[model samples]
Target: MKKILFLFVLGVFFFVPSLSVQAAEEFLYICGPCSRNFVPIAEDVIQELALEDNVHIKLVSCLGACTASPVVEFKGEIYGHMTKEKLFALLRSYFTL
Candidate 1:
């Protein structure tokens, strides 16, 4: 199941010719329902990650991970229980790819 999902995402990336060209500009959206302090965390990640080359970040509303507070989405997957440091690491890794 995991492999199939991975292949599906990979297929999407490979087929989107324009997307492959500027993959870095593609966004890492940190999202969650508005509550607790998720909004601020998402905003902070956007500000920090957007400065990187070919990389952009945004704060998205309602990614259905409200129970996890901070959730991050990129390349069609979502990450929960995120922090600023974790976001930094992910951006660095994805940017390199």
Candidate 2:
């Protein structure tokens, strides 16, 4: 019984790291107001890049970029004044299929 439990723990330790990498691939966030104004653009860019699965899109309440109401957070960087073209260009690095 003890040996079985030890093997389970060891197996999980080896398997968890790969999951983290998949979790790390996520890369899109739109603030509350941004969502209403920019979701379509965001969706189009995702479809254009075929990143429906490769990247994650999150709708947040506020990213502290209200000065630039339509704000987007991507890969840990905050970008305001978001436009479809700019978003498309920014996402090229991550989704190049």
On lDDT, the candidate that comes out on top is 2
lDDT of each: 0.67, 0.81
Tens-digit lDDT track for model 1 on 35-79? Answer: 336546545655666645554556777778777757778778887
Candidate 1 deviant stretches above 4 angstroms: 1-23, 35-53
- Lowest lDDT sum, 10 consecutive residues, model 1, at 32-41
* Residue pairs in clash, model 2: none
Q: Candidate 2: misplaced stretches above 4 Å?
A: 1-24
lDDT of 2 by residue, 1-97 (tens): 9999999999999988867845236768899764557988898988888788766778888898888867999988998988898888888865544
Residue 44 of model 1 has an lDDT of 69
